[model samples]
Target: MIMSTIFPEADVTEGLKSAMRLYASGVTVITAGQGAGRRGLTATAFTSVTMDPPTVLVCVNRNGQAHDAIVENGHFCVNVLCEEARDVAESFAGMTGKTGADQFEGFEWIETRVGAPAYAFAQAAVACKLTQTLETASHSIFIGEVCEAATNPDRTPLLHFNRGFHAIGALK
Candidate 1:
C-alpha cells in the first residue's frame, strides 16, 4: 500500500526566514570588481560544492549592489570572517550605512589573483573565477572555480545564528 500526504497553503516566507535564523553558518563577505567599481556584501549563503575542481557557490540577492558587479567583473572572493571581524561584517551588511567602496574603508585589503578585493585579516580567502550562474526567484546562485586561496589557521571563524554572532567551542 502507498500513502499520500496533503499540505497546507500557508505562505512559508516568514517561517522559512525564522527557521534559517536557528541555523548557524559561518559569515563571509563576497567581494568583486576592482578600483572604484569594487563591491561587496556580507553573506552566509555560501558553500563548497566540489573538491576535485575546487568549486564553491554563493547566493546573492538580485537587488544587492554587489550582484551586478560580480556578474560583470567575472570574479569574486569569499572572505571568511574571523571572530574579530564583526565590524567588517556589519559594514558590509549595511548596518554602518556604507555603500559601494565606502564599506571597504578602515580595513586592510588585498587584491586577489583573480582581481577581487579580499579582506586582509580574513580567516580564509578563496578567490575564484566565475564559472556559472543560476537565477532563482529572488537570488542568483554564482558558481565559481577557485583560482587562489589563502588561510590563516590561527583565526577562529565568526558565525551567525539566532539573529546574532557566535563563536564555536569544542563540545568535549
Candidate 2:
C-alpha cells in the first residue's frame, strides 16, 4: 500500500504534517532533569521499540529545553497522560504559559529509582535509561531501556488527533 500518493515538491513540511494528523496517537510528556532543573514537553511521537528488553522510543524536539538535559543526564520518563490530564499536557506543551520548573508546580510527581519523575496520576508511565540516541532532522530519537513502568488501567488514555485532544472510549 502506498503511504502517500501525492508527493508535494513545493513544501513537504505542510504536506507531511497534514498527513501525519490522520493517525491518532496518545499524548505523553517527555520529562527530564531534576529538582529546579526539571524540564518536560508534550509529545505524541512515542512508541514501543521492543518487548524482550522492554524498550521504548520517544521523539523529542531538539530545541526544547529538556533535550539537552536528557542527553546530558542519560535518562527520561514517558508520562502517558490520562483524559483528565489535558491541563498537564497543555502546560508541558507550553500552551498554559508555564515554563521551566513552574510547569510542575501544581502537579504531584514521584521520582523513579532511575531518577526521572513520573506523574502521580497519569494513565501510565515509564521510567527509562537512555540506551541509544539518534539525531533526526529536527528531533532526537531516544531509545530507552525501560527500568520501571506503571499504569492506571481504570483511566481512559488521552489522545491527540488533528491537533486536538481526545479521550479514548472503552470498547464493549
Any idea how many clashes model 1 has? 0
Give lDDT tens digits, candidate 1, residues 60-137. Answer: 999988999999999999999999999999999999999999999999999999999999999999999999999999
Model 2 misses residue 11 by how many Å?
A: 3.1
TM accuracy, model 1 = 0.91
Clashes of each: 0, 0
After superposition on all C-alphas, the RMSD of every candidate to the true structure, in Å, is: 4.4, 3.0
Candidate 2: RMSD to truth: 3.0
Tens digits of per-residue lDDT, candidate 2, 1-172, equal 8675676788787888888887788999988889988889999989999999999999988988889879988999999999999999999989999998789989999998788889999989999999999998999999999999999999988988888888875321
Model 2 error, position 129 (Å): 0.5
State the weakest 10-residue window (summed lDDT) of model 2: 163-172
